[model samples]
Target: MKQVTEKFRFGIDIGGTGIKAGVVSTENQILGQAYVPTGAERSWQEVVPDIVHAAEEALKDAGEFMENCISVGIGCPGTIDAQTGTVVYSNNLNWQNVPLAQELHRTFTQPVFISNDANCAALGEVCAGAAKGFQNVFMLTLGTGVGSGIIINGRIFEGGGPGGAEFGHTLLVEDGELCTCGRRGCLESYASATALIRQAKRTAKQAPNSLLCTLCKGDLSRMDGRIPFQAARQGDEAGQRVIREYIKHLAAGIANAVNIFRPQAVLLSGGISKEGTYLTDPLTALVAEEVFGKKNSFLPQIRAAELGNTAGMIGAANLSQ
Candidate 1:
């Protein structure tokens, strides 16, 4: 006769480029992890199988089989009908009406939960990261595009529907840069990491004497956002000018959020967030300068997200509960 092993939860993060999964415990520790390319190029058809493989590997890494698992949760980009576990749409994977929850349940016979990736990260931060002690957290991911998630009272506070907090779409300017959503001057257009790179390239082309010209090796499209930040650290004049405007737009967006939610903490995550203190410290200074108050009364204490890339998976696992 053999004794039963304790059950464990599984969390999965699905992105445009890859899939991340982890085995989590009741205490929120990630006991194991697995990764694989999303294979989105193969069409949404083959992508489903890729998800199953990733999940199986994570379970194997934990030395636990599916039968011993308690529940599973997935965090994905797009609108989700959380109650029905349906993915309304996803631009990265080009999936629509994806019955993600039912597919996982049929394959693994485990309870399944589905949520937007941003919401998952907000949940993860509340449960395990910078916002661990705070009752309210607002997370902004400034990557190829801007993604936002808000947590209130320890839950993903989608006011009514999935459209609850599309903060990135808030109009920053009218008729600005063209956006994939067919909008102009969306927050994502002016402040996303990708947007910064595009702006940097345009600047470098005009300011050929700047360091960006050398860093890009004359291939303007190759410029990285870090180049300008690095040059700024060196006191380069062009870098300073470029960064100043970047910070202005970013600060404006954040300041507006503060006026709305008055969250306990604002966590920033994603590639550009690595600018670290360079961005955080100055951002704090700038937001304070523009936030319409004297004592930092209107702005939240901004902090970098502690969970990093794993936030998505950690949040996914939490959704199962």
Candidate 2:
């Protein structure tokens, strides 16, 4: 393995709302942290400089000169060509084949690496989190939609160009709810926080006398996870239905992952995952039932991600090795 300290690596995580950059040590400790709004309205040309500025700020915060840095890595949300360091497409950024790595190299005068956000999260897991001691792991991020990363033998296996792991898009039902990826019956159609919210809204609309309806103030559009979860705790049948179905869909996805990768662990992140055992415990039981793998202790253990929002950048920095 390349020595992490032989050269400091800079990591930049460009999210839908903000950009986080930092100087990270080989041991996976963040030496410095800095942030800036993503400013979605700005074009990539305008965005590149903002990323550069964030990197510069991180270097300064770490009391390190630019010359000491080995490489700069970016974990971007998009379909990326990791081999070429190009953004093939991004739903949120609306960027296409933006040569972010090339642009960063031109601006910061250092080698730059870029990868899909899900892959970056997996890298973060292997580098510093639950998978640190293991070379193979799966990271499932339960956010507005589901995202996944597969780390095999300490490296991300990108299928062809920019694809890492897209568990969310896998079809679970025939002609289910439409997905942002333009697909129907995607796992995300039933399991994502957005999906949960949609379920809640429909239930709220029908159960006008329910507490969820009161929480949403009779507005279906305003119904969301918080209200549903609250209603579930308050023993509302509609909330219970939403949560149970969401868990089932999520479990099905995890079980599929287990059968495919046989990873050392399955890590979860994002706000929805914060539901904790309410999700993990049952998901584990479902995996035991659904996964085709041997009923042995070798089954992947599911856990929550420790790095939170910064996991992407942390994983990106470790890519320098």
Candidate 3:
């Protein structure tokens, strides 16, 4: 087996709108990278060629040949059969049972490993980011939707079959908000950046004279997740309310995960995590309060993700290890 620090790997991250590829040292350093639009509306067969092209471009940027890399690893959004290297379902890409790894392997002529994008992010963080020293970690990305990944004993934990770690889809409130997954009151419906933006818009409408309204120029279209946090910092009542509620909901979701997994660390990623201590400080306190065994057992450390967008590619590259 090749040592993690001694080899290069080709990594690809497949998203709804774009595909990002990187030539990453197994130790988590990115030597070169490339990006291309996903064109998800097209067929999976059409997209596979672009995926290969992106990898070729990244290798070119790194001034390396494809044969130099030990393997090709991919982080894709959707239900994946990792053992078979298949994408079973991907609503974002409109794909079903696509043999992703098989297609890429034919071009790269090497081992190909595939996993959910969020799972890859978690592994990347464990390899070289926020959860570097920990063996058990749970990560939640509060983006357009809440993306989650679980790592147990330094390996991605995918419950049992075709990608079962759907932490974002976990129930939060009973019949409260409709989620993108056609469910009601999911964690994503409450704790995501989209949910935060929606909360800010609601606050703006109810309190037209509040700082939130002023910040958005009285046009709700301009409201975003940051406006609430920004308003809270400036001592705005409505902004503070929005952030407070957002934290409460997010804490509930984090607390639920902690109670179940008892990971050593829980990381926050995506745009909302930029709030830093403003988000983590209060959220950690609330999660501690709500999690089971608060009085007698240890609680996980909740912190912001360090890698941002690069975590997925880096984690993907390390999958072969």
Model 2, residue 260: distance off in Å is 1.0
Top TM-score model: 3
C-alpha positional error of residue 277 in candidate 2 after TM-score superposition, expressed in Å: 0.8
> Candidate 1: minimum summed lDDT over ten consecutive residues — where?
1-10
Tens digits of per-residue lDDT for model 2, 1-321: 122333578988998899999898767778877999999788999998999889888877777767778788889887888878899888888888798888877877777888888889889978887677878888877778888788888887677545546777888888988998899989888887888888888877888888878888866777767788788778988777777887888888888778888888899888877777777888888888888855664688888887887789888987743
Candidate no. 3 TM-score: 0.95
Candidate 1, which segments miss by more than 4 Å at Cα? 1-5, 43-45, 65-68, 292-298
Off by over 4 Å in 3: 1-6
Candidate 2: lDDT of 88? Answer: 87
Instruction: Rank by TM-score, highest first.
Output: 3, 2, 1
Error of 2 at 32 (Å): 1.2
Cα lDDT for residue 202, candidate 2: 82
Better of 2 and 3 by lDDT: 3
Q: Give per-residue CA lDDT, model 1, range 1-321, as digits (tens).
A: 123345777889999889998988767788778999998777665787778899888877777767767778899998888888888888888888888887776687878998889989988888888889887888899988888988877788765776567888888878988876789998888888888888888888888988866777888877888988887788877777778878888888888887787788888888778888888898888888776574547567888899988888888887853
**Predicted model with the maximum lDDT:** 3
Task: Tell me model 3's lDDT, rounded to 2 decimals.
Answer: 0.90
